[model samples]
Target: MTAHERLHTRAWVLHPDIKSDEDRRAAKPALDEAVALAAALPDLEVIGANIVPLPRAQPGLLFGSGKIAELKQTFSENKIELVLVDGPVTPVQQRNLEREWKVKLLDRTGLILEIFSDRAATREGVLQVEMAALSYQRTRLVRAWTHLERQRGGLGFVGGPGETQIEADRRAIDTQLVRLRRQLDKVIKTRGLHRAARAKVPYPIVALVGYTNAGKSTLFNRLTGAEVMAKDMLFATLDPTMRRVQLPDGPEVILSDTVGFVSDLPTELVAAFRATLEEVLGADLIVHVRDISHPETAAQAAEVDSILSSLGVEQDRPQIEVWNKLDRLPEEERTALLARAERGAGVFAISALTGEGLELLLQEIAVQLRGARHEAQLHLKFEDGRKRAWLFDQDVVREETQTEDGFDLTVLWTARQAAQFAAL
Candidate 1:
């Protein structure tokens, strides 16, 4: 190879299956997901992946010394330059393992941070990821640097122990955090203004959310006819994208494609991405796209639900479960899943890639966005011109007769709109 030629880092992925953990996911699928995550980074070449069963975690090295020796042999044979652990690793464990295996190490959180750093496109996304990474780094600074012995000049109030390396690093991170937060706040304010402007428009928002690589972007492209980045990769779409499209036999609506969720999404990320996820909160309807062919679909759905609930998406919020990737399944399984979906309300079976059953899904979305409507005759007094105007503005008034004391109107409106009118 030429000296200037780029080379991918040889990496191995390991998911530690802890027996004592009550919430541990199945080992094989978890390891598969981890391997996919490692491959998502352009520079990493995933050479091998395994699920390392652990009866109990060792404090110092995570894996037992015997198991560590075995892994080291395998890694050395494969020329692995990096090890990706699919779970939390303490700073001590990470340092010890790297020293023993003579390889760079990254825990699940660190790997995710790397992916987010690589995928973030917008200014706000970049700032949020940097802040979250700094927060994560602040927790693992002990012995990470060699400057702990040196001390800078302090404010001369005599101190027994002067600033250490970790303390100085943390202070530096705090300063950076303050700056990033300021920038993020400004960006968030601007986004809020944009959201408020969108609200003034007549289009309702429909948000697509699901586990990573569940075909959301494909569905989004099919619905909006915009060529977004749709690939069979984790987090192919990190920054949210929005487009306006008219639903068939329905009103024009804004379709929002959001970042896909994953099991055990880093807490720092959740906090950092709040500005992005606020779009979901404002959505009139949510479409959860699922890869129905996957073995862990149920578990994935639960994780998505947990994250949504944590985000304060109310149970009563209108939502549809879209069983996507129907074309990938065998005929027998496809029929079974479709039958099951038919037994539920607000559920759809479709192949977003092939555009199968999309018309039905679109029709359902239109119905959900419209909500329940009823025709009623409303009598408003002359003093209630504000209410009368609101009815007209909503385009719900069918016929009106102006009387000396009042206006008599026939209106078709949803229950929520009626309540708003009553409030007026």
Candidate 2:
């Protein structure tokens, strides 16, 4: 088989609970998204999907023996090679399911990890993914090494190779974890130095965050004229990219495109990606770009909000919600979206693919960046030429006058900049 065909296989989704009408209703969209994601791959096919309800007190397997038997037969008939469970399954549970169905079984976390591993491009991103995968695999090693039983020596102490294998695996994983942490720490320190330098220049940072394939990069390119790699695939842009964007007032701010968030993101990934996500924490403004055309856009928005809150960034910062891809919507739907924007909800209806409503959004961002401070006039002695030069370098000077004793200057700057001047 070719590389694509080797990775491609038939997938079946099994959601463990569909007990009520509401449960089934709520699960349909998630199942649909999973199927859509699966379909995006070149070789994967979704032959069958079903929701199984479990009664109280049954714990060994999610479904009863009868259901398992039927599922096995169905898997055989459909030639399904893999089962994707929507919920997390224990290593033991996964092993049992694979044995019972005679096929590979993966839980939601594993599937997401696989996608991330495939999509990661940068060395840091790949290292982070590898760390997360190792952390996940350490727990699942039981399934892979089950044949090696724990044997005892002559004196009933721990035996030789068997015990050594377990210890060696644990020690190797610990060593790798420490090395990854050290590397990540270095990256974090470098980022901190960069942030400090940017602070000295003091350009407002505007970060774009949203669900996967929500046109964040498209809008980012439209606003900043940057040619970042934007595509329709999930997790297409894993590395954060930043560009200097000039506002309507000619004041420049840095706009950053961050990795997109998804539902039920892997815990290890969240921890691993925290260094990259520090950009959001340092942002002056956040542009939340949503694919308003998606059926579950609201739920996806909630997921983004939840992740932001977890990052301790949901509050205080000014957020502009851009309802992107309006051109794909029906006329009435677009009108309603505009009505929502008119309600002073910090929302804008825009088509990033085309150049609609972008100017107004840029103007609003400029207004926010401008409203952050006041202008000041200063008089300095000739010996204070250094301070004048410093002011010119650090803050926006609106007006300047030179005299024998001193130089007079008018500057527009933040209060923090003014304080820095006073210290000078």
Candidate 3:
């Protein structure tokens, strides 16, 4: 084999479609998604992928003996060194499969963690990925942990940590876990301090969330003009990025671009990123960007909704739906979708790539974020000069009269602004 060929690990993707599994997706699309995940790994060369149909998962090997043998031959023929399973694999199954197929293997959770670790650009993001990866590895009773030489910045699963084989030492892993948690807590506390400081800035937060590769970063770049890495790949953005921008007709807001979500996200990641996602909870409004042209757009949207609910995002939060990627749709389909979006309130069909229909979408964002305004009267004491000044600075005060003790003011503001004022 050529040295260049050996540089990349030859890999294959397998999506097991168990008939008894209630949540199984369409086999072909699932296979496609698995292949896309393989392509996301730069050091992995994907030779092929398949959907292995099964009546039910076999306990010991995850597949029937005959099926396993058939796959072993195929992997040997293709010189496949790694296999990425599109669903959760039991620790025993993972170990047995590696032995049978004579190839390293990673399940859905491990693969996602790898992508996250690779894309993590911030200290907080890196710490969260490491903590999640450690927790995931601890579950594999027979799996080896390479404690040293961790400078590679990944979970040490592919080739790095897996190079050294050792007996499972739960106590060492626990100690490392404790250390990671301590570092993560320190980072989160600093983030909390920053968020608290932002609370005094008076600008509402608008968060953009959706399934992976859903053009959220594209829209964010177009709106904010920041040079964020916007790409046509899953898990492209792993860290939360925020910038302040003034809308065309809306109030100036803090726009946040968050990590894209995926179906059946690993529980460890959900827990680890909970603090990162907490920023979403404080958002006054959410913009749901979607790849309208994707075959599984509906299913992806459902998954995003489920994750949002799991993250404690309430239904009462104000939200707008941006059906992105309109340019990829057929003319007939695009026309029909445009009509549908027009008929639906708070929904806009746009192409963030081509800048088509973005104007109206931005206008709607301004409208939705403006919220409803109402009038209120309040009296402030002489000692509350800061609070009185804040009200005037927001431009919400319509009238003010000086009194002996303090001032009487009449103000018109939205509920969001009112809440910010109360916080002050």
Please tell me which predicted candidate would have the highest TM-score against the true structure.
1
* True lDDT of residue 377, candidate 2: 79
Q: Between 1 and 3, whose TM-score is larger?
A: 1
What TM-score does each of the candidates earn?
A: 0.85, 0.79, 0.83
Candidate 2 wrongly placed segments (more than 4 Å): 1-7, 18-25, 37-48, 56-58, 142-164, 371-424
Ranking by lDDT: 1, 3, 2
Q: Which structure is stronger by TM-score: 1 or 2?
A: 1
Better of 2 and 3 by TM-score: 3
Using TM-score, rank the candidates from best to worst: 1, 3, 2
Top lDDT: which candidate number? 1
Candidate 1 off by > 4 Å: 1-6, 142-163, 371-424
Deviation of model 2 at 418, angstroms: 9.6
lDDT of 3 by residue, 1-424 (tens): 8997879999999999999999789999788887887787789999989899999999879999999999999999999999999999988788889999999999999999999899998889998899898888777644433333453466655555434343336667788889988998898889877876665565778899999999999999999999899988888888889999898977888999999888778899988777767779878789999999999999999999988998888887889999999999899999999999999998999999899998898787788777445678999999999999888665567779999999999886668678878998
lDDT of each: 0.87, 0.78, 0.86
Q: For residue 285, give model 1's deviation from the true position in Å.
A: 0.7
lDDT tens per residue, model 1, 183-228: 9999998987787667656577889999998999999998888998
lDDT of model 2, residue 150: 40
Worst 10 residues of 2 by lDDT: 17-26
